[model samples]
Target: MQLKQELIQQIQSIIATAKERAIRSVDTERVLMYWQIGQVIQEEEQQGKERAGYGEFLIKSLSETLQPQFGSGFSVRQLEMCRQFYRTFPNTNALRSQFSWTHYRTLIRIENQDKREFYIAEAAKNNWTARQLERQVNSQLFERLLLSNDVKEVLAVARDEKQPSDAKEIIKDPMVLEFLGLKREAAYYEKDLEAAIITHLQEFLLEIGNGFSFVARQKRIHIEGDEFSIDLVFYNRLLQCFVLFEIKTTKLTHQDIGQLQMYVNYYDRFEKQEFENPTIGILLCADKNDAVVKITLPENNKTIIASKYQLYLPTEQQLIDEVKKEIEKLDHDKMNE
Candidate 1:
């Protein structure tokens, strides 16, 4: 019996090692291929005196010839991607050996270099699959970071080895709640939205951003015979903090902020460990007045955040304009300061 157990263990160990080695080998080979493809495209472009059209023509010709011999991957679009792949990562040695070609395909589509680099580092560090990377990108991860921080802080968080420390790092504003199937104009109570979120909790968490895990809903608290129930509670592994949320179907009031503050204080005093940071409170409301929130909270309040929730996805242009306006307002405030 002992001998059989040992043999089985040995086989398992061998299989694990073989799988690890195989993955590494595949990664290395793919990285090398990308580098070589980049090199070939760069050389051809230079030969043609760096004319843009020359590269396109070369890809067209190459695709026509190579597709028959190599099957599906040699399409003109892919060849163009190879050229872009080289342009994006001019340093072959800098290519992350951990990610596959599909990962690069997603990264190359991100036009912002800083955002692209951030995704690359994160994807490699987290060992994220191509699909995960796609989801993160589609969720506007870069824009969320930018909204929460300055350019320097955003870049540092993206590139540095340290985990993000701020509450805003984990909080996503205007969180996509499309999975709830709630109509924007439809009149619904807070309970309806809360129920929908609970039903589609996993998708909601992804929309909420990284490091969030649901803890409880309508968590009952009793203190001195007075009872209170929080709408939702979550723990963020990345921020190492407990996040408390309050849902509101109407425009947020100062009273709502005060109530959330009380919840935050209670959690900090009783629930949070000494090692963990103070609990964060978020008011997820249909509408919020930035001026009211600023006045209601302490001057240096980091634990409390107010976010507006939308039932439906806004048009891309509308989102862009809103972001632009916010940036302008921030800049104006900075100037006054």
Candidate 2:
């Protein structure tokens, strides 16, 4: 009976693998066809000496002819999209087979060449589905990372040109938790938030960035006669260290940093192995003051980080405000120096 069950499972796995490969093959062919269409349209459009009007007429006429026989996939908008796709990724040889037509459409809409390239490398490296790619774009993941690091470092890390040396490289600040279904207006305790995170662990892990895996929550430890609980703990494969998180429902204070520092110290002294890197401490607070954090931690501190959390994704104005704050902080630091 056991042997029969094992044989059935093996057959099921083989069938599933074949089905997935077949889907990927079809998607690859469709992507290639669109790129070819785009190439032809682009060549013909360039041949017309006329400006804007000629390109529009050509695309519209082609769409009308193709839609009748080939269906709505050849609509004017789609043709325009294909044209843009080819223009964005001019080299046919450079087009990634892993990306579907939807992925190409999303990438084509991004006007910035460098940003597009970063997303392309990251999407390919991470094997992000079309919807996952779209969510990251919509959530402004790239811009959020840029809030602390510069474009050069961001792109280099994504392209594997440089390995991440700091937690800030991989962990995003002001993490958006709109996926938790927690209402922005509603107040949540640290425990409630922790429960929500446990429920939506997958999305939380995705938003937290790469190379992280969950370890424990409310991890209790006793030091001599005293007892303490750590909110959350994770292991980062890339950094090769244990990440300790302490959640705060209100604004971060010096005490919060000190407590988290204690947790980090405990892990480093007792939990960490000699082969592993130092444990990293992170405070997921509703709000945090940069000045307070800077004052609390030593200038050479690398293991401690305080990140703000938001229930909802920020609006355009909110991002602008955050950028302004970053600039002001830089100016303030320079002046203090």
Best by TM-score: 2
**RMSD of each candidate relative to the true structure:** 3.5, 1.8
lDDT of 2 at 53: 86
At residue 337, candidate 1 shows an lDDT of 92
Q: Judge candidate 1 against the unseen true structure and give its global Cα lDDT, from 0 to 1.
A: 0.82
Worst 10 residues of 2 by lDDT: 1-10
lDDT of 2 by residue, 71-149 (tens): 9999999999888888888888998989998898888888987888888988998899898888787777888888989
Per-model TM-score versus the true fold: 0.84, 0.95
What's the true lDDT of residue 160 in model 2? 90
304 in model 2: Cα distance from truth in Å? 1.3
Write candidate 1's Cα lDDT for 197-254 as tens digits: 9998977876776678999999999888999999999999878899998999999999
Q: Each prediction's Cα lDDT score?
A: 0.82, 0.90
Worst 10 residues of 1 by lDDT: 310-319
